[model samples]
Target: MDNRVLYERLGGVFAIAAVVDDFIDRVLSSPALNANPLVREAHHRVAPAGFKYLVTEQLCHAAGGPQRYTGRDMKTSHAELRISEDEWQAFLDLLKQSLDKFRVPLREQGEIFAIVQSTQTDIVV
Candidate 1:
């Protein structure tokens, strides 16, 4: 019901987009992530718009955007990739770097990280 909470949660779509851009840039630049064929050629180019929407919608809902996440499940999409532990760690590290690079506040970072972390098992297995 509170628009301001939603705004704060979402941080505006542009803010979320900025963070995503930073994160994706870092991920792309990281040798660990770039080395993966799925990421390098397939996932990287194709996933951004969906990713952005995912973040925006989740943040908006978490922060109080109205839209519920009815998207495809994570495990289904990521399970086949067979991501290794090292690569998973690299993904997380770059994610942290991206948030830090953009100066996302600690609370916000923690919140976002927690939300993202929820997908780890599905994504990494």
Candidate 2:
């Protein structure tokens, strides 16, 4: 059996960061996501590079990498955004686009989606 952690399967920090970069850029530029004024403001308020760094760290940690995420909890971080179910789905769709663009294997994508799904309750209002 392939026993590699999701982080290893995903090619470690460099590969994870590359995907985060693309995903964040897509999120930042998406009018659908930005339709929520709070999301739009938050996207513009934070430096793109720093946001990407945190996401990479978070994903790496969640994927069982050596990196530890130093960011705030999902609930606290997203508390004020007031995201809806549709917006959340839109976000997931963008993530899927990123994974597909990178040609991430199906198993790895499923693992990543599971990680993302765990945060949905905290993120969606």
Candidate 3:
């Protein structure tokens, strides 16, 4: 097993957390995402900082970092949102924008995207 992990490649927890913070901010404020009544309501209900923390934990865990995700499962959290394909694509675009802003390497971006893609079925109702 290659001892190297994606977490280290991503500059560890702090870096991942930074990216998550930016991504969450973008998602929470995106007009496209908020256009959906359910999404808008949930976005307004959840605390952005707490949402960022959970996303950071999930990302760190997915990248093989020490942190464990304490948030709800993707299906449970997103099922009620009823996200459309367009909204899902918009979310992905925002993630890519965030990754680009951080100058994430292509390989790391691909790995991160794969991890995110794995949850698509659960998230996109």
TM-score of each: 0.75, 0.98, 0.96
Using TM-score as the yardstick, the better of models 2 and 3 is 2
Candidate 1 — which residues are off by over 4 angstroms? 1-10, 44-55, 58-63, 68-71
Model 1, TM vs. native? 0.75
lDDT of 2 by residue, 44-82 (tens): 999999999999999999999999999999999999999
**Judged by lDDT, which candidate is best?**
2
Give the CA lDDT, 0 to 100, for residue 8 in model 1. Answer: 68
Model 1 worst lDDT run, 10 consecutive residues: 1-10
Question: Which RMSD values do the candidates have, in order?
Answer: 3.5, 0.6, 1.6
For candidate 2, what is the lDDT? 0.96
| Error of model 1, residue 43, in angstroms | 3.1
Regions of model 2 farther than 4 Å from truth: none
Each prediction's whole-model lDDT (CA)? 0.71, 0.96, 0.94
Q: For candidate 3, lDDT tens digit of each residue in 1-125?
A: 33589999999998998999999999999999999999999999999999999999999999999999998999999989999999999999999999999999898999999999999999987
The superposed Cα distance between candidate 1 and the true structure at residue 51, in angstroms, equals 4.7
Kindly list the per-residue Cα lDDT of model 1 for residues 1-99, writing each as its tens digit. Answer: 533553465467677768777776676568887687776775665666676667566655655555686666888767667787889899889888887
Which structure is stronger by lDDT: 2 or 3?
A: 2
TM-score ranking of the models:
2, 3, 1
Error of 1 at 76 (Å): 1.4
